[model samples]
Target: MSSLSRRKFLLTAGATAVGTAILHGCTSGGNAPQTPASPSTNASPAAGGEAPEVTKAKLGFIALTDAAPLIVAKEKGLFAKYGMTEVEVLKQASWPVTRDNLELGSGGGGIDGAHILTPMPYLMSLGTITKTKKPLPMYILARLNTQGQGISVANVYKELKVALDSKPLKEAFAKAKAGGKELKVAMTFPGGTHDLWMRYWLAAGGIVPGKDVSVIPVPPPQMVANMKVGNMESFCVGEPWNAQLVNQKLGYSALITGQLWKNHPEKAFGMRKDWVDQNPKAAQALLKAVLEAQQWCDDPANKEEMVKIISDRQYLKVPPKDILGRLQGKVDFGDGRTIDDPDLAMKFWRDNASYPYKSHDLWFLTEDIRWGYLPASTDTKKIIDEVNREDLWKQAAQAIGVPVEQIPTSSSRGVETFFDGVKFDPENPKAYLDSLKIKTIKA
Candidate 1:
């Protein structure tokens, strides 16, 4: 096929798929680096009353750049500022381990909580997604970021002069089909946010997750290595990993999830529901520290320094350059294409960013149903209400002086027009599933 024809066909078929915010740096004292300021609210404990110190608490995190808020909180003294000294932020290998560690309190005595994909707590609520029916009960302390998940493809595909557009994405797949070589793509976990985001983007591009393409679970740390060895062609994962690919010149980001859905929920601070209930003050204090960290990390002045801090062996352990590539919105697809302002994967604070809206939670559940993880006729609303920890989230926000907006009072279910007219909606997950002219399975 002519190159022009191939491009047009990919775009026309809506398969030309595929693919954060530029995090701003902050200047603290002009040289010392500004750490996040604790929200000045009632949750702030005074100098007296034993300071309400948390004697010892463990927190779990997977090593992604979005985990920076927590890392910075600990490294920059935000946690200590809030009396959460003796805080141990354990680096986990994968999302499931992170979730299990929090649920069972299993990481070297386990952890008090975790920074997790938004849907984990909800999925945990049903007691089906993971181990333990005890329902360790959880709450979203605050949203860490709204942007920063992306899809990436190997340099070999881009060497074919592949465009990162939807049409180009599909054409690359068609080429794969004609070549009779299986295309392997990776996601960090199944039934969580990354899986859903990757699945939806692939479905929208006319590729079925299981049938049209080979989808596998590879932990975030191994994604780049797996791609380098040709074990996978593309991957959908959180930051630093994608940045790792760019730095290694192995792959280019085919698309970013944030572009597909503006300000989408990516990660949140989660605590055992019981923990939040019993230590309401402590929960608020924890949220205060994290919120401050978020704001501090969001500042443009700190971006360069953040690159240095996150590159620490204890955190992402990647070169600062790779982490800086995507963090600064400088993306190279390795095919003689690069774009700045690649749309930042923002860590949204208050407003709609911080609120754990039922609509957002329901949308993920709908995807779970679409992908056969849940039965097709599942009661999405029931599952959403049971999983969405709005009550706890609101209390934490209020305690931290963060503003609480009213939850979206009405259901927003319909076709959502995304980049170049790609539509996504939860109302008719099936229709959304079916419209792509791609392969799909009944959930």
Candidate 2:
């Protein structure tokens, strides 16, 4: 077959696999039927004792384990308990689809908010990755999760034993290019968490992402299928896709992202700024419900039920086994390596995981600048101040009686240290960028 035909065939096969997964209960676009809201209750009073102005919200989620809090809130009646009776937690096909639906808004047959990549709202607010390059102001109410994502490598590279250090694959990628087969790596979306993770992994190994190997965007669900068809050498995505890849014996996880940066921020629960401004009480109600759900999901005793509920056809649609292990921090790298460390597990509420720290947001923006996704001249702090609604998170946590200890004393999580000894001091992102050996933006 011609190379073009072969490429098309592979993509088609991957698409077919994605379709099958969707049929088994993944969400696709705005047309997917909404999951019926749990039974309603008396409208819960908001922070200031005002009743919610509206009871419904159209929220989007992809089929990943980090999205558990949103799914749990919807299934366990948390949303309804907080007076959001008509909340619809619909499934989204991919990150780009989620962005499109969020841009459309509920009134335009889209979503009002989503379980989204941490950098996405800032990207959207800046109009960098939008349909018309028009800014859509957004507010991040709370962080959904911390540290459950993974970078996976194809079994072909098993001999190299590529893990957190990607240097082993640098020469291999160069050889492939010299041999007339340019390798490609996949992530979920440009400027999204997966993309940044993949880029950082490769660059840390002295591999220039877009230059050394093509970095393409593949929706999270399709990562396994695409790798199975030889469409990419590696991928970065949230679980249980990585676990599924290992389960299917298609690839071995290089590293769970916690190893990249322990307890690093992953996803956020964000909504259209206009929506939040117009319906402040309803917004707090939604936040309160999700906050409660986060605490529920964090409990070790609830792990079984949490996995079962999210594995249903309407949510993630995967076997509970594929999700439970990683969700509990029992990682089987699928290459005969296993570790049980709850500290590296996906955190929903513990360790202030639910707080939308301004420092974390700044790190994301700083990384975006490093990759030239956002200009070096960008005012990251101003954008972060405007977009990160940590104050609202504090309000919801207090309203829900979250222990004062759980509520962060400061918006910054302090300096974060990575597996490679790289430090990102929230107070000085410029120095962090300067310290990086490979970056598109010069420090």
Candidate 3:
């Protein structure tokens, strides 16, 4: 497995230090106690049937509406049409819990796989989990959705007349720069995409994530409640959390991730490595079910119904309106801002958005190094190769009838540019990291 290069790692980690500090700092207050899950009631790993005769399987997800394809796959009987039977979908508690149960192979977690953030399966496979007994094999079968994340400010900030704009969406940053009162923003995790995206957006607009504004980590499900009480001035998170705020008429979207990076990868279908190795056919069949579901979801006619199914108590558990608000790319800022831009956020398609590229995986690893999660001098290329299960993703996509071009390639891709002019090249991360004007420190 390739590791992150020390030089590049230092650069990335330096840029992201503030975000990671916020993650570790904020969660230290202790979060809502997690509901313990009973051990697996299902048979052991050895109990799965031989061959792939039973087409149906159970999948687990937190009731976020973006699990739309999974919901649609079952609701439309697409899984059944593909020879899947008894396609049971279970809701999970949170990202960490979702990851743990999947790794442990227990509880409402009797899944062949699940809808996960792009970085999760990679982290689990790498044994990055602090207390996991043993690392399990993990692979992303296909990308599910992209660019549904947003930055939302609290009603108090709106009442206080804070400015949110195309540049520097954080109102607190400008206040601090001019020596005004400090404001706060919240995110889910330190090294995760939510934190990275939030930091990237703020930094691009000339706001320093750590110095210019105060950022905290609040679990995704708790974002709206936190903002309502003014625990935070603004937040950056994925749907339907942002949409939930709008539906409650409490907050509004200042920036959508798509505006940050069009057709970016956000979520994916991931399974344990051993599960994939042992049940390649089962994996392929399930991918077929989801790919078909993806096609259906992309259709405008099916979106309303798709929103309703995913919004059920078994899924996101939010109102269909909130679920559909962002899913359909129909924004409701609640402060009197609304628009319809379907392509602004994507569900599925043939673009690289659905394929997990090597560079994309490398980018996250770069972040891991930057935030001091790994040694600053690790081999970046080696780690990128190991984390990206491209071969497995390809096999699954082809089995589902997706075109080969839709699968990722190993070609070193150019770094993405924020509206502010920072560039990230998968091939030359060190130079990219060195170019940043942000504060840097040793990992």
Candidate 4:
């Protein structure tokens, strides 16, 4: 396939070292846990299908609200319904911590699965962004949610009257530098979703990233604190942190990511590749429960309960008010922009949101190569095959009773248009990269 050709080219181009330098740092997503309780052994994975090799598993997550499906599945006993009764949803301090914990591997001080950046599994398999040379192979079982993230600037940004207009941001950044202050913007991790969002936004505004302003990596939970302490002028992250920033009066929402790109893929339901290989039945069981939970999260009636569930001291630890507004499609920009936009809110299921499209993974791979995170000659298609678990997701979806018709006929979503009018064609990733006016590729 053409993917193989690209893979051969990447290896031929000597990009191994570039991938190594990135392993020491990176970022992704996840959420909370309830008090440990063995799931009731009611539903059985072995009833009519292949029996799972293992039933108990530990998964990791962050505080972001997009992690709702995982948290809900665990809290509501959905995992037990599929016989993954021992599943425990542990809260992670940051994305780096999540990666490190995953590297430890299941039962070895790490987790077996996670809710994470869609690109992360691909990067991990290629050894482009991990702490191990072993290259943990990860599977994208389903998407957790999409498009509830935002870029928030400190209160001073209110003067700019901005929404996708970064020129004002650039002018403010220049002014800050002229006053002897270096402007720093933070994202959850390097080479992850937030990083891409922040980079795209900054570049669109004519800011030369590292030159005009510094882009720093901060943990998800630490974003607000970092901003409060003047560590950064703005940050791109998932909610309810973004919403919390507005509630605390620390910053104003400059733009919602959904506005940046409608229905964009966000966090994913991911597990170790070996885990799937050794315990295929168990993996399907996990997907079955999580998929059900995704449907539950997408329900308008369940959103309020989901907000309250994740708002627990153990889950998101934020007030329900902070999370409830956005959960119901209420956007308070904190800059005098408020819109009841249910159309643009977060989605866990519906609209073919959970399918792990090979095209989207390719897009992220292209972005990795576009930036310095991966080598320009990186083999995207080969790594995409190694990381994306669409085949497995199909199996789980079928086993869970998702109609054959609901399964996408094609994995590619075709060429997508960005808010800036940039087009990303999965069939021609190189051209898409070349079309970009700003990039970090090295000759």
lDDT of each: 0.64, 0.82, 0.62, 0.76
Tens-digit lDDT track for model 2 on 111-199? 99999998888888888777878888999999998899999999999999999899999999988899999699988887778888999
Model 1 C-alpha lDDT versus the unseen true structure: 0.64
Off by over 4 Å in 3: 1-58, 107-112, 159-184, 210-214, 403-415, 439-442
Q: Candidate 3, residues 261-345: lDDT per residue as tens digits?
A: 7656677777776666766666666776676677777777777877777777767777777777677788876676677887686
Error of 4 at 346 (Å): 0.6
Query: Model 4: per-residue lDDT, tens digit, 324-382?
Result: 89877899999889989876898777666777777777777677677777887776766
TM-score winner between candidates 1 and 2 = 2
Report, for all candidates in order, the number of backbone clashes. 33, 0, 25, 5
Q: What is the C-alpha RMSD of each candidate to the true structure, in Å?
A: 9.3, 9.0, 11.3, 9.4
Q: Write the per-residue lDDT of candidate 1 for residues 2-43, one digit (tens) a residue.
A: 122211111110000000001122111112222333333233
Q: What lDDT would candidate 4 get against the real structure?
A: 0.76
Ranking according to lDDT, highest score first: 2, 4, 1, 3
Instruction: Give, for candidate 4, the lowest lDDT window spanning 10 residues.
Output: 20-29
> After aligning candidate 2 to the native by TM-score, how far in Å is the CA of 89 from where it should be?
0.4
Highest TM-score: give the candidate number: 2
TM-score of 1: 0.80
Q: Model 2 residue 283 lDDT?
A: 96
List the candidate 4 regions with Cα displacement exceeding 4 Å: 1-44
